[model samples]
Target: MSKQPASYRPRHAVILAHPNPASFNGLVADAYCDAVRACGHEAIVRDLYALGFDPLLREHERPGTEGFRLSPDVDAELDILRGSDVFILVYPIWFGMPPAMMKGYVDRVLGAGVTSAQVQHRTAETVLRGKRLVGITSSGASKAWLNEQDQMDSLRQLFGRYLLHAFGMKAYEDLHFGETIEGLDQDYVDANLAQVGDRARAICAAIASDRAQGQAVPPAA
Candidate 1:
């Protein structure tokens, strides 16, 4: 267990994109939070739908545009985000992609306060730099079919590679739970959730290892 001294434990921001609180995506987020908490860490679960987070990107807010600044809402979110180490996004996929809300979060939050030139030149000081990203996506379709269409590949390129590179994140992974329907199979759901917990544990372990290594290494003179 993490013993969780104030500001001492690793913080995980679990971004949940499901409108339905009872959704599989929600469950996945829950399992992740539970597992991390069990490990003595903190979990900040943000349900975008419930929070009524605006996903709209204003034209004036674009980095290159004049009078560019983070919105009050975005600032609030960032206040909640600052000091967080890991980010986990849980959403349901439609048409082989995340919904507008999910994309909006990335555009408005993850992609905020940075210039296009910075991204292209890798000059932006990304707040997410050296952090970890875990994406959990649920779909009604089969993984094989999605792969045949190269949808997952495209998503990986967009999320796994581009997003990580743009944000300077140390690592990224997306776990897809497919064939998820209204009436889910209990056994299958349990198994998938177990996997989610396992992943959470692994992340906690990795975070601990990273902290240990950082402490062990001496700063240069």
Candidate 2:
């Protein structure tokens, strides 16, 4: 497999949001991280469920309050986010959206005074500009059903357009693996896992190409 140049290798923060260790989402996350490391980048995998991340935004954790203060856990996660050049999110679609823990991570860790700055008479200034985000989601429903119900579009809007753009980060692909695990053969599962590895390599290559050309990485379509 081709590797990214040492100078262009980027730091990656991989967030896994599934509760079950034996789930397909966990397999994908492991494959992604392995590919990232194989491509010569540093990959840190955070299993939110395993970490026992609090999915609630308490009043004290609310932004703009005198009592607003991040817990030690949030602080540590924020540090990982800040130190990484790329973010990879692997989760299962729960009610057509990311799980509560992932949403809570956004609310608390990426809240005001951390990943963004408020400016008078304008939108919040995104402090995470120049970073990249990629999301990999799995669903029990068929892709056709998701498309018919517009859940795919909703996912794109929520993660790619709204969330990443809000943070001024480049949205670099969102892969949805639908019809997950139920009645699927091992061959089919292996194929999807291979694709995950391929995507990881592609991400590294894109970043390296951008650096080589001295250009900002373009958002993935």
Candidate 3:
């Protein structure tokens, strides 16, 4: 039998979209997963599209009644996700947001008993406390255009604050690449992936080092 760590073992869950292997977003997601593992963390990858996870939030799935029961696949997803100290979202921005598949994963997995709940008239406090989160995204717009449009920057306000902070994520990071529209050169895609992959590794390394030293990993500057 293999030996295990004495007490601590860093665990991470990475969710990805874009099932197309030729897609730049998919390549970046794979690279990030590899980087996380290199940092000695147990990285779990969730490929939303390939998994065929239903994104629709029907009334039957709502919290309450027998309809709230999760399907076997969803239950498996929850199990993998709940074991992590860090959660990573890797996808491409389509029309200024994540794909439908990823959105659905959030709807089902991040629901009641996972993130937060309600108590009568007021909302209750969030769970998923002490967990960290990060995102890696690629978009078609040029960097200048996106900055001018405030797409990536505005996203932080949504996922970082409203979504993640509301659910008690202790840390969050985003790695975004742009100018990936039609006719984009393959060289650019490879270069961007290399840069983002290194960045991911650095971030995870910093976290591991901080934990090893018994200090909190400082947030991105």
Candidate 4:
């Protein structure tokens, strides 16, 4: 078990994308929050469905336009994302991708003039530099099947590499919980949920390690 720095308690933001509270994805999110709290950190759980997060990006929320504006909901989520040191996304995979609400959350909250900025003669500058990302995805398919289909590869590329990198985040861990609802037995599901707790602890440990190494923590916007 890794210990947090005695001086600082990192804030963790856990975003729950599944609509059903009884779902396995929700259980994972709950487990993560409990583990984060056990690590002596603050945990904020954003339940997208319960909050009624609008999945559609309205015209006003579009980027690179004069009249572009953010809704209060989007602004709030962005603030949470910026303030937290560790970001965890818990969602169920639908058709080899995150559900619509999670995708929309990424689309709206991670928009320009908020999480990133374009620079001349350089790659897009990300305001979310130095933050850590963890993705917890549940799917009905088996891990072997997902690997054979390259679904895990796609997730790693999209979220762990491309998306997080665009946000200037370098540290990431992607955890896949397959055969979650229908195809798996209770014991296997329990094991995956346990893994979620373990991963949460590991995330806290990594943050403490980074701090001990004098890594710069990104400033909140």
Candidate 5:
């Protein structure tokens, strides 16, 4: 039997939504996995829908106490996530929010002693710090239209303020490709693809830069 490579280790966890293989979201997810790997960062891609992830916050688990336990499969996912240094989300915005399954994953996985935990009894500070995040999304509407609505900014707030900030993720980035559904022009699609690739490069550069500078980034909104 061949031995495993000692040089291989994953550095990033990419959680993807949208079930259709033919969908643009799927293509973007694939691109991200490739990009991350090319930069020498191991990438763990979680196809939330394909995994049949249960998104419902069980009635008993609503308070997020020890109300629910992960099934064998979910437990496995949580374990993988726990080891990741960079957490990336690649999904399409439906009505300006995360897909149901992705949202549910957060509800189930992020809580006390997991994504975050309280510190000292006096200040109740958080210690689950030191992580990075990036959001990659596709939209059917034009960029101008999305700009008018401030869709991307609004989403940044949702992730930065609610999830990353709360969980102690230090840095955050977002990339969007709008007007996908209007028409699938090869030129247009290629341009967006290039943009995504650029973002991936930026992500790699930022990681190295931040580390080199000894900078701790605050989660962005």
Candidate 6:
């Protein structure tokens, strides 16, 4: 009798919302997953655009509806997220915000399958609670200019902090690369990818420490 391979319980999830397979966002996603695996931890990748994911939220599917339900896609996404402690989002910022695809993912997947109907429902159950969020985003504008205009801070507040607080996640970290327009320099790309790899290693180390200490993180509100 042949022995089956050991089960894989993914610890990190890398989600990409880039339309082009060869885009920088795709490269970042690949680098992240590879780095996580190199650190001896499992990581799952989800390419929303490549999978033709539906970004629309139908009226009937609204939360607390008479018959609120999640579509098969959302269910699958949630299932993947359930086992993950770290979620890394890779995308290109457009018009000072994440692309529509990423926004849709936030609504359909990160929102979780079901939420309590009443606002201020202090005890609502959420699968994403205690998880950590990291973001790798690129933009056509320069990073200094964006920071000068307070756009980066805006994004950190609106996307990272807001999501962290809303979902009860543990932490939020965002890294941005600017001047990513056409004819971008290869050196810039390499530098950013190196940083991405470094971040993955750091996160993996932290997760390992938590596991070793038998930390119990959950039901955060």
Candidate 1, residues 121-171: lDDT per residue as tens digits?
Answer: 766675577789988898999888889999988998987788788878888
Each candidate's TM vs. the true structure?
0.93, 0.85, 0.81, 0.85, 0.78, 0.87
Q: Taking the tens digit of each residue's C-alpha lDDT, what string does model 2 give over 1-221?
A: 24345465588888899999889999999999899899988888889999998878777676677777767777777766765778888999988989998888777765534423442322444335567888899999988999999999988997766766566676567888988966788998999999999999999898777666665455788
Greater-lDDT candidate between 1 and 4: 1
Q: Model 3 segments beyond 4 Å from truth?
A: 1-7, 64-67, 114-127, 213-221
lDDT of 3 by residue, 97-158 (tens): 88888778777776544423443322434334567778888788876788888887887777
Deviation from native of the Cα of residue 185 in model 3, angstroms: 3.0
Off by over 4 Å in 2: 1-8, 112-127, 215-221
Candidate 5, residue 123: how far the Cα is off, in Å: 9.8
- Candidate 4 lDDT by residue in tens digits, 1-221: 25444676788888899878888888888889999899998998889999998888877777666688888887777766665888888998899888999888777775445423542222544335667888888788888999999989988898667766676675788898777765457787778778888888888888777777775554687
Mind sharing the TM-score for model 2? Answer: 0.85
Q: Please say which candidate is ahead in lDDT: 4 or 6.
A: 6
Q: Clash pairs of candidate 6?
A: none
Model 1 Cα shift for residue 125 (angstroms): 2.2
Compared with the true structure, what per-residue lDDT tens digits does model 5 show for residues 112-219? 234223322222222225777788888777767877899777888986555666665677778888877845988877777777777876777776675545544456
Please report the candidate that would top lDDT against the real structure.
1
Candidate 4 residue-pair clash tally: 0
True-structure lDDT of candidate 1: 0.87
Instruction: Please give the ranking of all candidate structures by lDDT, highest first, separated by commas.
Output: 1, 6, 2, 4, 3, 5
lDDT of each: 0.87, 0.79, 0.71, 0.78, 0.69, 0.81
Candidate achieving the largest TM-score: 1
Deviation in angstroms for 37 in model 5?
Answer: 1.4
Clashes of 5: 0
User: Which should have the higher TM-score, number 3 or number 5?
Assistant: 3
Clashes of 3: 0
